[model samples]
Target: MITPTSDRGTKQVHDGQDFVEFTRTFRAPAEDVWAAVTDPGRLARWIGSWRGDPADGEVWFRMLFEGDEIPEEHMAIHQCDAPHRLRVTSTSPSEEGPQVWDFRIDLVEANGVTTLTFAQSVPDAQLAEGVGPGWQYYLDRLMLAETGADPADIDFDDYYPALKEHYRELFA
Candidate 1:
């Protein structure tokens, strides 16, 4: 059974931009957590995999969980500090037009536990309704993946509608 309290994200404003953030702590080290989020092969175990070199400041990411019909997303790496921090902008196509998302990940370790903070800058509460639950689901999968557990065990249905109101209230 999935716990209702699994949603621990918060909404915040930084530098005049609104953001929805989620934080997860792992007993593993920062390096392991970092690899889970950055390494293409490791990421494939949870969310998605990427191609192209990050040193080029961009990569193409194809989500493995979403099936093969979805197009690959283009991500521009703004900042990357191995095993610690990462900032990127993701651009994808939508019915309205091109959608761009700004994301930031930061990690801190102390006495073996590594804490990862994931944030996405959003324009409004409407956007966060989906973004919040989506990230919560993905981050939970990430936690499972790092522990060698099957991330596939998690269902997207557990997140979306269940937490949509929660996110709407937070951003509203």
Candidate 2:
């Protein structure tokens, strides 16, 4: 479950595109934090794992922590600047049809601390209700993973529904 101390994301517009953004800080260096997000092995500890060479600008990502029937998402890397920024687009099967998602991750180091900013473009506020908390859960899990703690200790139930209204209000 998420504690009151856990931070929530904000809604913003960049170039007229709606996005939900979250920020996380790590005592580690920028390169270390960057590897935690980009490296397939490190990612598997928190969010998910990926296959295929990133140099190919594409990879099949699987969300290991989600559920049993984990589907591989086709992620296309749009831009990659090591230890700083990464932009990617992913296509996943949705109830309506194939859903395309745009995600961005940026990292900056100051005073030996790395600040990681993550953003995902959303089509509407309704979607952000769920997406916001979902990312919060994963990002929190990432924190645990980075500290060598079990990410599974964080529950999704504490995020959704409970924090849904907070995110929905961002649009209002």
**RMSD (Å) of each candidate, 1 decimal:** 1.3, 1.3
TM-score for each model: 0.95, 0.95
Question: Using alpha carbons, what is the TM-score of model 1?
Answer: 0.95
User: Candidate 2 at residue 124, lDDT?
Assistant: 81
Shift of residue 128 alpha carbon in model 2, Å:
0.7
Cα miss at 164, model 2 (Å)? 0.8
Residue 84 lDDT (model 2): 99
Task: Assess each prediction's global lDDT (C-alpha) against the native.
Answer: 0.88, 0.88
| lDDT of candidate 2 over 33-138, digit per residue (tens) | 9999989889988898899999999999999987878678999999999989999999998779988889999999999999999999888879889989889889
lDDT (Cα, tens digit) per residue for candidate 1, span 28-110: 89998898899898999998999999989999998999888888889999999998999999999888998998899999999
Off by over 4 Å in 1: 1-5
